[model samples]
Target: MPVQRRIFGRPIPAMSPRRMAVLLGTIAIFAVLTLVFTLPSSIPAGPSLGKFTDHKISLPKLKHIPSPSILNPFRQAAHAPPVQKNSTNGESSWYSNWNWLSPFSSSVTLDENRSLLPPLPDRPPIYTYYDHTIEKEQELKDAENAVLLTWRKAWWAQGFKPIILSPAEAMNNPLYTELQMKQLEAPMMTEMSKWLAWENMGTGMLCHYLTLPMGSNEDPLLTFLRHGEYPMLTRFDNLGSGLFAGSKADITAAVKKALANPELKAAKDFISAVPPETFEIDPKHDALAYYNDETVADKYPKIAGDIVGNGAKGLLVLNQLMISHLHGTWQNIFNRGIAVVKPHPDHMSYAVHPARRLAEFLAQCPESPMPSSCPPNRPKCKPCVASTPLKISTPPAYRNTSDLYTIGTVPHPYTMAVLTAFRDDISIPWIRRESPRDPWVTALTKELLGTGVSGAPRVIKFKEAVASQYGTAHSLWITAEGDMPDDLDWHFGFAIPRNATDNGRSETPVPGPERRPPVEHDFKDGPVPTEAELEKEKALLKRAKEFGEARTADEEKIRGAIEAWNLADTEAWKFARAFLARSSVERKKWEEEEKKYAGGAGAERGKSEGWGRWFDD
Candidate 1:
């Protein structure tokens, strides 16, 4: 059997238990040693043990770095370090052998020092400031009221009855209220102050506010004062046919109704003649007739001396008329002898000047006679004259003369000239330069104080003085209406026929401030304007004057043309004249159209016509 097994070659025999055990143990030991040698150690490379661990090598110091001992795993000084007393200096510190940890915590670190805020006072500073402002406003109000009171007393004493409107009633019309009127007065007040100061120094002038009433007799202010009523509100008619609320009839009716009130009657009883001392001369006796009787020189006085007195010797006739109207009771106030009702443009009696009509005709005349220029019998022979018959009438009992002519609706160009001169020479300059704290104002204030006048009276003395010098102090109409205290409605259009609309009627003009709108100013709190700003303002005013002058010049041209055209008797001229003779609305439209057509023909014609060129260069 052994010999046969030998043939299988190398067949393994079963080992003994002891030998197998020993071999298994030895193999286990060898596997364990190999695994132990191949596995990596858990320790990481320390910061100092890396490439930077070379002798004398240094690492850059990083900014804003945190403590290293606290972050280092090798160091365990994160908590409290061992405390040790300094043997040499008797000082105590937490770090003894450990050099990294700080003795104190981060909470106690004092790196940067800064100032601390002081404790606030019991009362805030803002409250004090507010109180001061309120007090100041009250003081100003008191001062203003005092001056107004003094003025009222002085005027009342001088036999000037207050044309006071009910504040509550005036409240209905925004323009008439006290507060609103004050806004309008603000600029005037500044001028008034300057004027007053100048007056205190003996520079006599007149204020615009003092010279005019709150409104003209035709304005609603009269109705409001006389009747405590407003007229029926009508729609704004482009045709201009609608009756104005403040008509004579309305005023008369209001006056009649108002007479029933005993309070008004009692107030009327107080009316008396002004004192002699109130004026330099007997104003009523020396009054010059402005409309017809006298020229400006005849009505006004020449200077008493070579130096020329600062003021006129006597009151103007128109001013006297205005005053008389104010002084008279409602019963006799609107008497025809004194106050004639300004006629409405829609009335048949409303007439244009014949000269104006003639000028218009001549302006339309062709250089060479057209078919219409000459009649059939006299073809191309002579220029035709457009005939306009004058309406002749006998003078009424009120008139001294019987041959009175109807005045044209055209306002004289002199008014425009005067307005321009005033604006450029006086108003604009005053507005830009006037200030309440001006030297003049200070001087006046001192003078007032010297006279034992203080508070509002002292302040108001300035207003009074200004009124005498620059304002219409002669105008005694006192309105509670604040917005339009000047008694002017500046928004009204020109009353000329050329400005008429296309509705075959003229616009109802309001008798407000006759001059151009004034520049806005704040003499109270506004900063003084620079030279550049003043110059700009002056330029604007100049432009305004230019515009006004241009309009006036255009009106003059139109009037001249109308006169010339009226003289031409040609059929075309007659027909054109007939069209113009129609309502002002129609005529204005025709004139505008004529100018437009004429402007296209030649530059000379274009340059000659002025009516339709308000915006044109």
Candidate 2:
């Protein structure tokens, strides 16, 4: 017989009767109730019973995003790299696996500040593009300035000034005893010396800064920075910082000379319009762009692909590359783009991808001319709304994609309901503590998992979010929102060390390396819940229950029959949204019944006042 092969320590195609049981139990729970009075599908129609409260609310409009260009298919010349080469098997491959200490790939959503879009559901997507050359140019210019400012903030955020002065402080502080000062000065001065040395060398500076990736000589982050054509610095300000502050007089003199040229006036107008905040690198996902007359400038990819579409894979790949290059390590989808200077547990962490300059020209705009990034002229400011409608589609919840980050198809209602409960009710330790169970989550979980909803995955690896090959959380199926996360099973960050036969050290990824021996954090010892536990959680069904409080035997028989039928018709009723809509037949029937009640002098109030309570129970 063939040897039992293990992939990622877990068997492929997965294992168990465990899954079968989970599946069955989930199904039995989520199906809708049987019809108490003739299939109960009819709904109230016509004039609605809309609740009207003067409660002030702010249903913010969806954020507007420039519609990507779908007109031009991603044009690749015959000589371009083959597009089919993109693979979803992340870290498993040699390329991504080699860089262990590096940050996660793009496609993982990480948002630091507010999101680009107002979020899904309440707000529709924003995908309109304006043809305004000057406007986009101005937006880029503003973004570049913002980048510089954010870097300046970093200096303060990191408390660089104190850290920078530490060496000098050790030697100069008189309060220190002479011997103590000497010792203090030695180590502090040594660290400072090392920092300066690494700074000069650039790549080696990473080693002096942080532990693991940054400090490790083996790390690839420094490789990324040095690999660029211009040798991009750890901080962009390093570029302008080199220009002496004392040289401002000379710079001003040169500026006046260039200003004399008539051509410079238009350039000045564009530069004057760039808002500084646009360039503020969030270390998460934020693309600030402005399209100049000649070219478009934005940190984000300019390619337009369809939802789970055309060039999305490529764009996501590029995003991953950039993240790996910038932050040393990051956790995405946990809450968009969360960057971890060190190791972290959750996959979905908040992160931000600061706007990258699309081009040099757009980076110089000044902010005075209504630099809202909106166009001044009518032709360019076309909104996707009334003009060309926006089309939005989520990843498939049911059908699996060839790639890792995308979910297969829309999940079943019970799946949605289960996830909804998990998202809202169960608070993972980091984000929340002692969050109560949400009613929606309670209902959904009971219907799907505890109840045995169909199409539901019996076993879910609740937390696992690293697979450099695919995108991160936000970029994947489960967004910061409580939707389904795309590839729970596929992300393979944990590299288990197997028998010597598995692979040699050479095969191990350079960044993460092979994990230490083996430790499953085994939960296998957990005993099943005792009978007492089951009794506490179990609900009671009262034999005295009846529909519409009818205590008569006829009413009891009809109600019992309805309940029994519902158990058998689980699938059809689970997705029966039609029942939620209003029906004219039901309305007329109710109206007739009301007229009869009025003619019969209110028919002496029913004997059962709170009769339907048990059913709710």
Candidate 3:
């Protein structure tokens, strides 16, 4: 309150002259600094609103950008300079007056000092190897060597690599077709039997006769007889068509040629002494014809005689029907006839036979050649035997009595019967159908070998063959029964000796009379049968036995009746053989008589004059 000054109608104190001068100087200095710093920043050429404004202000207007030309920089016209029409040369020029204006353009100068390149040569063929003809000759020679080796192996009964048929070949194969036809019901049953045979043979059993197509080149019969050892012949002639045309010399020559191969030198013994009796079927008759004819025995010697003559020690005629069809060949060979045994209808079809038991025994005693002596201390495996051996003129069963003192005793050569527990009829369409559960030999073998026996027929056969002493017998006699069905399950059985002495017998003690062993049945996957069930099974077996006996009796009667017919056949055959033996002599005599009659001209004149001319008159 010293002095009050009015600023805007209010009283206030006034400042001194010095203070006023200071305030004025401060305001002037601030104004000068703002003008110097802000003038340049406020110019419209470049302006920025960074950190200065407080009041609203108008923004500066922006100028419009110029429209650019649409011409493409990469255009053909842009890449090269225009041609100078007034110049002497017609070539284009690269130099331009304004080329430096473009930042993307190169600074290097372009020149027209280029020349054309030479043309390329023509292309050669893609493939050109012309030595196949020479290579084929080498391949053929290699094949010959392989064949020679295989032939020697087969001769040794070492088995052979089976001929694998192509899909096309299999479909047309006659043997395969027959197999299909025969096993249509149990389509895989035959295969199962074959596997069993193969297994048995491999383990300890004797060599088996495998059914093969007649014309197959790979057949063991043919392999030994004709083509396998003959490298020069690419293909063998079919049997019976003209098998006898070639002489023994030709066979010897083939053997010699085969031995010439260095690879086969070690096999000379096999080639040189290949048993002449290796071929069982006579080459004079067609195989199909001989198999079908029942009178073959009557026309020739008995089938057993033929077998023995061909060096067979023992013959197992399993298909009794087939043998019976040949009149009395079964009785003549084995001294007994087999009757068919029908299986229970409700029972699942399976294979059970003495042969299977023999196979099992063989599998168990793989190292032992004689199944009876296996394990040494085990009960001597007793086998079924015929009451007496047949007295044949051909040859007696070979005997090897030296081993009797060493290995206890050996039984006389005998043929045991192996009966199947299945229905023989498969001709009916309904019976032929099968399911996946039905056992297939190949599939069963793979499954059993891989995972052990799962109750498959193959496994069962192996087990049975191992458990039984049936192999102790010389051969097996398999029987079939009932209405001889055409589609029978693998009805034939044969066992071939691996060595020349297969029929040889030791001086072993003779087997006692036939006696039934106590049955020791064990269940692998099911409970044992009740007393009633056991009784029922026994009754069923009794009925089956009675039926079998009745059938056997009937068969015996039929055989007796047929025996008379066989005698007639024998007489006829005897007459025919006797006539044939003197055919040449008779023909010579007839020719001589004709010549003598022609020479007698007086008799011819008398005959012409007497009745012939008079009767006509």
Candidate 4:
């Protein structure tokens, strides 16, 4: 009989189920390389496995060996493994697009390539972390698989690899909230302690995450951790050896430098370690306490010193102004009263929140929540009360008496300098004849805060305008909360113009803590105005000064009484008139295009020429 044809092409197939299954299994085994288990070191002496080309492997020359037992899979215990940097191709290459934007630019060197940042180094892995976004899913998945595969590959060994780190924010992450992080950190620290007991990694070595200490540029802790790596490991560990870069290095160096100064870290290591100081999170008590205790040290007394000392002087002028604005000064009695306002940038929760919250309270309110303060009559107010919004009053009123005009290009020296330069064209010289009945100026007495769209430029137009009845250099005051980079230019393009009078008019120009934008008198530059052009500034000062001081003192007393009564009344307006002498003008001008465009973008991203013009009225 002819062999029965099965289906396709007349082939008679009569086989046992086992044989058929074996044939299909062999095909699958050769076709895909997705098996988690190890491939034998060698294959049978024949052609080669499916898709095995010369570029991939020379299987014919390879030795054959039995793979790991399937039943015994996952039975091996492995050390924590390092990550590897491997290129993906083959099928993946089909989906890959050739996109290359080197963040390091072409000028990168081997040192730059090697100098890496420590990625979110919380002690415990962020698997248990909240705030996971879709952007992180791929990275998290890839990292997990890579970690697992590395351990699987080595049977029971560990591994690690190098990678560049980006800014924590753009890096697509929210650090673990302190409470939740402590949950994981406690366990990690405990496990580490036990691991040390079992493996005896010495006390010289540490396993904490890369966290800097509070209120300090020097991180003795980090320096100690990095330096200890050499002594602990018999084999090399890149993770332990070079875990910090940039500012971290600066901090470590500063720690060593400060230690060498015969004060901190001088007598003993253990003793020099940060001590537990009892302190409140309240800004007033904290500022006072911190300043006092901090002053005990001569060299590195306290970070608070920056606030109370230089900051304190500014605070004095500001306090007087607030006092005058609240009660004593009659400037705003008919509804045009002035007050001081501050714009604060928020801070990280775990590490810096308490400091910020405290600082804000101290700044806007008196040192005591009670109305009784320095000047007897100044009214006290709640930190967040709505008494009035005055000019931004964290001060040496913004002035640019600097020589910022040599032809050159360098990063501006901080936000202060930038705003100082921008000051020339940005402020309102004086308001035109608005009524005392105008709601904002008269009734509400509110000052406008700089409100630029997030990621957009700061641009706005003033309605009716007036020339400064005060002076030509229209500088003002401000207060910023976050970091003010050293490169920020507090006195850039807007050099305070020379007076038409004698140069002895050496007044302190506009000043604010590094990055905060200062208040502006908001006017223009012509040949410097002459003394003949001056308004009655002397009479204005004499009349305004004593009244300002007395009113400030009285307002201080009233503030104390108000605080004692648990009222929200504030002294913002009383002092505002005494300090601020700006007259915003109505004008058609395009000034500070960069500021208009600078929504916190870095160097290249900042605005172009700062001058543009609108139609003149």
Cα lDDT of model 4 by residue, 138-160, tens digit: 43434333222221211100011
lDDT of each: 0.25, 0.23, 0.25, 0.22
Output the TM-score of candidate 4: 0.16
**What's the lDDT for residue 135 in model 3?**
29
Give, for candidate 4, the lowest lDDT window spanning 10 residues.
Answer: 458-467
Reference-based TM-score of each model = 0.14, 0.19, 0.19, 0.16
Superposed on all Cα atoms, model 3 deviates from the true structure by an RMSD in Å of 38.9
Give per-residue CA lDDT, model 3, range 1-617, as digits (tens): 45565889988777789999999999999999999999987776523444345457888854552212223355342343443322121121222232222211122222221111111111110100011112234344343223222222222221222221112322333334433443322323322223222222221111111211122223344334433232222111222211221223343343334323344323322222233343233332222112212222333233435433232221222122122222121122233222111121122111111222222221121111122221111122232222222221101111212111000011100000111122222122222232112122223134225434342333233222211122111222222111111111111111111111112332212222232232233222223445464444444433433444454655445333332222322122222222222222322343345334212211111111211111110
* Model 2 CA RMSD to the hidden true structure, in angstroms: 34.4
How far residue 33's Cα lies from its native spot in candidate 3, in Å, is 99
True lDDT of residue 336, candidate 4: 23
Regions of model 3 farther than 4 Å from truth:
1-356, 366-517, 522-535, 548-617
Native-to-model Cα distance after best TM-score fit, residue 587 in candidate 3, in Å: 36
In what order do the candidates fall by TM-score, top score first? 3, 2, 4, 1
Q: How accurate locally is residue 246 in candidate 3, as Cα lDDT from 0 to 100?
A: 26
Query: Which digits, one per residue and each the tens of the lDDT, describe model 1 over residues 1-617?
Result: 44323335776676779999999999999999877876545446467456645668568876664565544568743433333322111111112122111221221221111101111112100000001112234444343222222222222222122211112222333223322333423333332222222222221112111222222233343223234222332112221111112333432333233333334322311111112121222112111111112222232223112112222222222223223222221112122211111111111111111222222212221221121222111222333222321222211111211122121121112222222233333233232344121222223245235534323333233323212211122111110100111101111100012222222233233212332232222121223345465454445434433443465755555434332222211111111112112212322333345333212111111121333221111
RMSD in order of candidates: 39.7, 34.4, 38.9, 32.5
